[model samples]
Target chain A: DAGITQSPRYKITETGRQVTLMCHQTWSHSYMFWYRQDLGHGLRLIYYSAAADITDKGEVPDGYVVSRSKTENFPLTLESATRSQTSVYFCASRVGGSSYEQYFGPGTRLTVT
Target chain B: AQSVAQPEDQVNVAEGNPLTVKCTYSVSGNPYLFWYVQYPNRGLQFLLKYITGDNLVKGSYGFEAEFNKSQTSFHLKKPSALVSDSALYFCAVRDAGNAGNMLTFGGGTRLMVKP
Candidate 1:
């Protein structure tokens, strides 16, 4: 109930198509983050939002776009999905920043063909 | 740059024995270190953290970690391992002076406990 959630827990999209993954948190956390998890690379940040309308790029933000229209939502969009873009996406929320602990969502598994 | 290293890809421990998963970090200033656990097909869960104050921090599921600032290491340890404790453990650190809520995570270590 009062936890982070991601929509479409599993997704399969074709290459070059636009795909969006939704993330919502019930805690009204100020900071929301999107990360992609791969086999070799544990988890790489895609984008993060400090607050509503305040977004920042992370380590691997290319080809991805994110926006926080409200405190409870932070959605990630892939302009043109590729095979490399397919990975498990995780959404996390923190009341503050990294100085505080983060709570994560179940995660969305995406496969691009 | 800030980074975290989890040297071992996998760790094997027998039930009732002590267990340890090594982690080393590099940060600009005083580091905020954390350990998270993840079960198969699930999101990462908070385990323990060493922000300030104490060096020996105990966490959920009877797990504890010792922070060695001198060695830049914060290793997770459990006095007695359990079969249920097996999972993927990750060590992470935030970049110094930047409160971006961005954490650099290690590649993760798979812990397997044998009964």
Candidate 2:
């Protein structure tokens, strides 16, 4: 209840369909990040927000979209899901700055068929 | 460009034996290195970090890491491995001066401690 949480722990979506994964953190951290964990690639950052309304693309951001309208919420949306996008997505939050450690949510397992 | 490399895909150690998981990094500037562990179907848990100061950094669950700046390596080590310590280990790095503060993660190494 006091840590980060992700909705729809497991999801299945058809190719070309739009899907969104929600992440919420109760810690009121200033930094939120979205990462996709895939076989052989480890965890690659997709998006990160320094604060509300401030966001930037990470390594693999082409197929993903993210928004942070509120400090506690940072949702990732896939405009058109692809089979390649099927992976476990994780949401993380940090208090402030690059030196701080991040806390991760359970993760959302998304399968694109 | 900043990046992390975990050379070993898997590590096997007997219970009560010392363990080491290798990790090396490359960055344009000074790096902030970190180690995290992940159990089945769970999120990554912070292990330890090497920011500045002492080369040996102690972290959670009796895990420790030694930072060798010259070698650009930060290897995770633990004495007396336990069966419960078997999990996926990740190494990450961030540029100290970068404003974005995004982290680059290694491919990960699966540690299996046999009893």
Candidate 3:
């Protein structure tokens, strides 16, 4: 399909373990974003990439790393997961120019125990 | 910097009654506002957006939002509430000048519709 998709829709890992969430979009959108959704926080941006090799930090980027090696792929990695890091992660993409709305993926639910 | 606020944590409305979810935002440049609904265990779905032309924007599922620039509010509304309309609603804002495609989301409002 020509939509955004996230890998490992559900994941569980122990604290201090490293894990990665993969995001791929078939539309070849120039802008890809990673956001974490918590209980009280609707959605906080973790990282975003304007284009391949051009990434920037968002509101809550600490403890998370992201890279966009290809236009269709943007991966987020947690070096050492913590309980606080466990949340629903969403991947979104948007094409540049006149449109500003973003299309979101199904989301990945991560649990750190 | 851009920020969005959804004042009501939860809203209760009866089926066939009108419902409203409030949202306010602050941004440095021209504002691009959007509303999204998230069903349980699903990602956010884009509802409607207010870009430039009209102040009153109609969205999916018969939802509409009126953008009041002076008041800095984009409140979502529906003529008659439906049971299926109950979901977590979020309001997000992005500054038009922001080249990074960053959006600030509100805390979200849980809408409950009773039959």
Candidate 4:
């Protein structure tokens, strides 16, 4: 309950539809990150937020959008979902620093048909 | 540009035996290396990291990694393996020169520990 958590641990949506995955962390970490896990590609960062209202694109930011209105929450949105976007999404958080370790949420498995 | 490479796709070991998972990285400057484990249907769990100081860094669950700067490698190791350790392990790196602190993860290596 106190640790990070993600909503709709599993999701199914159609292509071209909009879907949003929610992530919340009780730690109130300054840095929040969104990553997608895919076979062969491993885990690629989609977006990251340094603090409230501060966000930046990661390695694989195409086809995805993210917002950090609150330090405790960072939500990722798909404007127009595609089959290629279907993958396991993970959210992580860490204190703002050079050597801080990141903590991850359970993850959301999204399938776009 | 920063990138990581996990040479082996999978590793198999017997319980109680020593285990090793190899990882290599390329970064623009000093590297911040890390190891994470992911179980079935689960998110990645932080294992260990090598920021500076000692070449050998010890972390959670009796896991440790040795950072070799010359070789640009950080291999995870455990003295004795357990069946519970069977999972997907990922190696990541961040370029110290970059201020964003973005991590680049390797293609992950699945460890199969047989009891």
lDDT of 2 by residue, A1-113 (tens): 66999988999999999999999999999999999999988998899999999999888999998999999999999999999999999999999854568889999999999
Distance from true position, residue B33, model 4, in Å? Answer: 0.7
Candidate 3: list runs displaced more than 4 Å. Answer: none
User: What lDDT tens digits, residue by residue, belong to model 4 across residues B10-103?
Assistant: 9999999999999999998999999999999888899999989999999999999999999999999999999999999999998988877688
Please write out the lDDT profile of model 3 over residues B42-72, one tens digit for every residue.
Answer: 8899999988989999999999999999999
The worst-scoring run of ten residues by lDDT in candidate 3 chain B lies at B94-103
**For each candidate, how many residue pairs have backbone atoms clashing (under 3 Å)?**
1, 0, 0, 0
Tens-place lDDT digits, model 1, residues A15-112? 99999999999987889999999999999999998899999999999999998888999999999999999899999998874457788999999999
In the predicted model 4, the residue pairs found to clash are: none
Note the residue pairs that clash in candidate 1: A98-B101
Clashes of 4: 0
**Pairs clashing in candidate 3?**
none
**In candidate 2, how many Å is residue B35 off?**
0.3
> For candidate 4, lDDT tens digit of each residue in A5-56?
9999999999999999999999878999999988878988899999999999
Which candidate, 3 or 4, has the higher DockQ? 4
lDDT of each: 0.92, 0.94, 0.94, 0.93
Cα deviation of A9, candidate 4, in Å = 0.4
lDDT tens digits, residues A22-45, model 3? 999999899999999999878999
Q: How many backbone clashes does candidate 1 have?
A: 1
